[model samples]
Target chain A: MDNLSMQKLLWGVFWITSLAIGMVVAGRLWHMRLLADVSVRSRVQQSLQLVAKREGWLISDMSIRSVTPDAVIIEHRQHMRGRDPRVCVRIPLGTLEILPCTS
Target chain B: MLLRVLVFGLLQGFAVLLAELHRYLGVHTDEAKYLLNIPYPHPPLMRWILETTDGWQHQEIFWRIVFASLLTQGTWFVWDMGRKLHKDQRVTLCGLWLFSGALLLQAGTLFMPTITAIETLFLCWILQRIEFLKRWSALIPLLWLEMLFVAYQGILFAPLIFVALRQSGIAPWQRWSAFLIPIGLLALYTPTNPLTIVATGSVSGMSMGMPLEESVARVLKLWVIGGSMALSVLGLYGMVKSKQYPLVLTLMLVTAYIFVGFRSFYAILFTPLLIAGLLSAPKLLKSSAFLLALQIAAGTAIFLYVPFPEYSSARSVGDALRVAGVHGDILIAGSFGHEWQYLMPGPVKRYRPDFTNDAAAIVCLDRCVAIDRQAWQRFPQTTEEVWVKIRD
Candidate 1:
């Protein structure tokens, strides 16, 4: 590869990486409202809806077994929040309560 | 488009899964690079998941990669978009996407679950950039658009976008006019410990080898991409003169060819061109197949012949992982670390990603003497039954 091609390739890598990353950030910035509008309410309501779906037990087959200031244990399902660096909270199986499928 | 993704995505996932060789990955290749006391975590994550979850053995390591491999397909989408705009339709872009660059080296084959997913996510965003900027043109959407413009981090294909745009008569900076995106993305990224990013080429603090090797490898990688691009242009010229645009996307094949030929992480951004080539142009298929054959054969020979000192599969390290599984976790007493994780089932990774707390770490140790006491100490919970298995 000649110097120009090398330069182009390097520049190609640098700018492309930069642009894609920049756009991802831009998307987040632009979509922040949409995401928040979607994420927070949906998170809580989805959990509640999940609870409501259970048969007899208020605890569905999967429910949070323990809640602490630092962590919340939603049994059986591991909820991973955050990308790039993922922050994960593992929910043990025992904590989950499966609600019978309502026929 | 959705079916296109599914058809190609499943093929990619299967290819990567089949290409994966457990012995090479988990036992001794990667850790050998860093020449570190620490191990990589791909296999240990799988082992840990297996141990922690109990008998879910039927669930193969392939599934873990599959979950995240969608992002791999997403990348294929972006490469396609760029190739389309270039009006080149003379090559097999998709096959090249899977076979070239670092992909040819069998990357996703040996690592953790999210490894492929992260690559995929970055690519999908690149694909969306065209539509968002072209149609929406809304300032509010620009914020979302802004997230994508990292200078050199992800979506390593942005330069291609600019290149294609400039070629197509779009003014420079016009595509990115809505928002100054890099600023917003800064929020999402935890600042790289500049030293680590430079020295390690990653944020994780994994200990590695002589700086010289890493630098040489990186330099060679850049060279390969440059060379491939020239070959692609040569290939493009060969086809462009022939007047075959409708059934084959030349630029898509070009981008795909370069990525597959170079075999680097950067290939992730270019895979989408393959998808695009497949969707729009089918003429590049013959060329793509030939290039892929050449790349795979050469890549296999390169890896097989390259000799870095610490990478020894000769030792009975393979037996240890199996024993460790029986023993709950092996605690190598005197032995230093090897690529235990990559050699093992992937998708099972450490939070730190440096691999200290990984299962492979527990299996292989700086001190090989620790192996004798492993039963009593490491898996204190399973001593009774586990020890008998070890003895027998």
Candidate 2:
């Protein structure tokens, strides 16, 4: 094939390959976001419950304020010493396994 | 037409301002270095400009304004270049939109030499295209000024300028003089040590001599994350189809820089050309607006959801040390220790293993914090710890 034709063929291949890769990446990111949306709140709640139980407090309410890959900030109302107050705690996901109840 | 361009510039400037605000609220190691005027590799022209303009005051508002202005100029130049190449206003507008939609704006927001270099490059390209230099002798001084201010990547474009001069029907001796004079003057009088500047080139966190697969994976990850996967793919396809050899060459050189451990910010330099190429692609022209919208949406989603590095922790730690009456000589020990060095209140000294004995405080992360628990007090709010020497 002539140089122009060869160049066109290579570009065609590149276009197809890039499109396929882009689709896969987009799909994976969307899937991850979906999973995070579904599971992150529940996970945060579980962690807060565990913390409350270990501290001998009643878990009145729990909510995840923010979710990051490495850390989650959870706001939970706990009844401690005859007082109920909302407390926000940042939990490092990496150290979750070493939490008092889990350990 | 002039009013429309002005509006576009205003929008681009506003976007840059937003990105700058985001940087201030989040982790920004390199930006801090530039603001603080910490010495590093590359020319000090960018830092000098920031300092002279009082960019360090008011939470770096002045710096942000300057950066936004330069970025607007860059966007305008890119649009003009696109118009020259494609001769279609719609296509040029799409190219500009693609660029304004991407994380390239985030790179432009930083107080870094890369953005300045990019703006200078565009100016050079524009000047060449316009035949602004009637005499070859005139380019020598211009070349010298560019070399002094533009980053190392700017050197790569020297040959292009040379080619332009040759094509302009300049006499052979005059062309050679234009090239040789800058080199001769730079070699004789440039204040910066060439060796030190070259050594500072490896700005990426990646270690040297990494495997080929790892390097390729790093580039791919950077493209996916930094450009938005859809836009990155489209941009690359566009470049290939457009057959813009200079754009391709620029992309390849940038990829090589990344492989050799330059930071991912370098990837953003390709955005203007990539956008131009994308707009030039025949298959993409029909759906250009739809694709541009998708890219903007994806870029926005990633920008909002992603957890960027928080340099605020380091600054807080630095504040804590200052409050505790610790001053002078801080030894930073960790993977990211160097990044936090600019947060030190005073002139930062190079980290030496022996300085651990005499330093006022030590800031360390991860394993360093774990190993030196007895000597270091763990800062409550951050992963890093401050080790204040107990002088009896």
Q: Top model by TM-score, which number?
A: 2
lDDT of 2: 0.52
Across residues B145-177, which tens digit of lDDT does each residue of candidate 2 receive? 445443555555454456555665557875675
Summarize candidate 1's per-residue lDDT along B1-392 as a digit string, tens digits.
99767877676765556445432344333322122112122212233332332223423344435433544454455454446433333223443444444344334343321243243334334434655433322322232233232122223333433433333333446445322343344435322111112323432232134365564555345334322332233333444555435213524433433333322333333333334323333343445556556655544554465332344442344344344553222222223333432233221221221223322334323222323443334433321111112342
Task: Please provide, for model 2 over A33-96, each residue's C-alpha lDDT reduced to its tens digit, 9 standing for 90 to 100.
Answer: 4224546646655665675444423232333444566665545442111122446666676665
DockQ of each: 0.05, 0.01
- Give the docking tier of candidate 1: incorrect
- Model 1 has fnat of 0.07
Over the full model, what C-alpha lDDT does candidate 1 score relative to the true structure?
A: 0.35
